[model samples]
Each structure stands twice: as structure tokens, then as C-alpha cells.
Target: MNFYTVLEYIGMFLVFVGALFLFLGALGIFRLPDVYNRLQAGTKATTLGAFGAIIGIGLMRPEWLPKAILIAVFILMTNPISSHALARASYRRGIKLWDRSVVDRYGPYLREKEEKEGKR
Candidate 1:
């Protein structure tokens, strides 16, 4: 097959994979036990899914590649930041984690900061 045709096939495959990730992300949001876990699902998976779809679109329409890549980069940069902000807000607001959650690195950090400030 020609180069463009091969690219089209790859684009189609990416789109399919992106859609699957999107579906799984949605399912995880609903099925996950806590807000943090849901946010994890929503941000990480959806970000990847969106990136895949955008890149796939770029592949299929070569002229649109630059814009698609720009959008993908924007998403990549923002998604995790937004998710972190949301999680931090939730934590500060005293939202409890799932009973089985194993780690809480943030709590200690926050407490240390507070102690330092109080001592000042």
C-alpha cells in the first residue's frame, strides 16, 4: 500500500484504541469507589484517549497534523495538573479516601507545612 493509505490504517487503529480508552475511563469513573480514583480514571485515561484520537486525526489528515499535535500537547500538560488540583482541594476539604487506600503522602506533607508555618 501507498504511504498515505498506510497512515490511514494506523490512524484508524489509533482512533479505535482511543475510543476504547474513553469507554474504559467512563466506566472507571462510575465504578471506582472514591473521588480520587475516579479522578485518576477520568484524567489519565481520557487524556491518553484524547491524545490518541487527536494524533490519529492528524495522521489521517496530514494538513491538520500541526493543530492536532498542539491540541494534544495542551491536553497532556493540563490534564494531570487539573487532576492534582482537584485531588488537593478534595483532600483539604476533608473528603475521606476509600477504606482500602494504602498511601497518603499528601497528609504528612500538609501537616509538615502547617507545623513549619506555625513555628515561624
Candidate 2:
């Protein structure tokens, strides 16, 4: 096959792979007990999934490569930070954690803050 045809196949493969990740992320959102867990799944999975599709599109369409790359990079950089902020805000607002949560590393920090504020 031609080079462009090969690239098209690869791009299609990536799109399918990305779709799988999106599905998994959606499942996690539905199955996870807490907002944090849901956010974790949504942010990471969706980022990678979307990135995959973007890269695939870039590969398939050279003219669109620059814009796709820019978008992918932006998503990679911002997704985690947004998820973290959301989780922290939920925790601060006293949102209950998952029953399956084995540890809470942030609990100590939250407690310390509460103590300093005389709310503990």
C-alpha cells in the first residue's frame, strides 16, 4: 500500500484505541464511589484517549499536525492539574471518600489545617 494509506490505517487504529480508553473512563466514572476517583479516571483516561486520536489525526493529515499537536500538549498539561484541584476542593468541602479507599495521604494535611484554624 501507499504511505498515505498506511498512515490512514495507523490513524484508524489509534482512533479505535482512543475510543476504548474513553469507554473505560466512562465506566470508571460510573463505578467509582467518590468524586476523586471518578475525576482520576475521567482526566487521565480521557486525556490519553483524546491525545491518541489527535496524534492519529495529525499523522493522517500532515497539514493539521501542528494544531493537533498543540491541542494534545495543552490537554496533557492541563488535565492533571484540573483534576487535582477538583479533588482537593471536594476533599476540603468534606466530600466523603470511597469505602474502598485504603489510605488517605491528604488526611494529615487536612487535619493539620483544621487544627491550625481551631476547627479540629
Q: Which candidate is the best by lDDT?
A: 1
List the lowest-lDDT window of 10 residues for candidate 1: 102-111
The candidate maximizing TM-score is 1
lDDT of model number 2: 0.89
Q: Which pairs of residues clash in candidate 1, taking residues 3 or more apart in a chain or in different chains? A: none
lDDT of 2 at 99: 82
Candidate 1 lDDT tens digits, 1-120: 999999999999999999999998999999999999999899989999999999999999999999999999999999999999999899999999999999888888989999999999
Every model's TM-score: 0.90, 0.89
Model 2, C-alpha of 17: deviation from truth (Å) = 0.7
- lDDT by residue (1-120, candidate 2, tens digit) is 999999889988998898899899999999987798799899989999999989899988988989999999999999999888898889888898988888888889878887999963
Cand. 1 Cα-lDDT: 0.94
Clash count for candidate 2 is 0
Q: Each model's RMSD to truth, in Å?
A: 1.5, 2.2
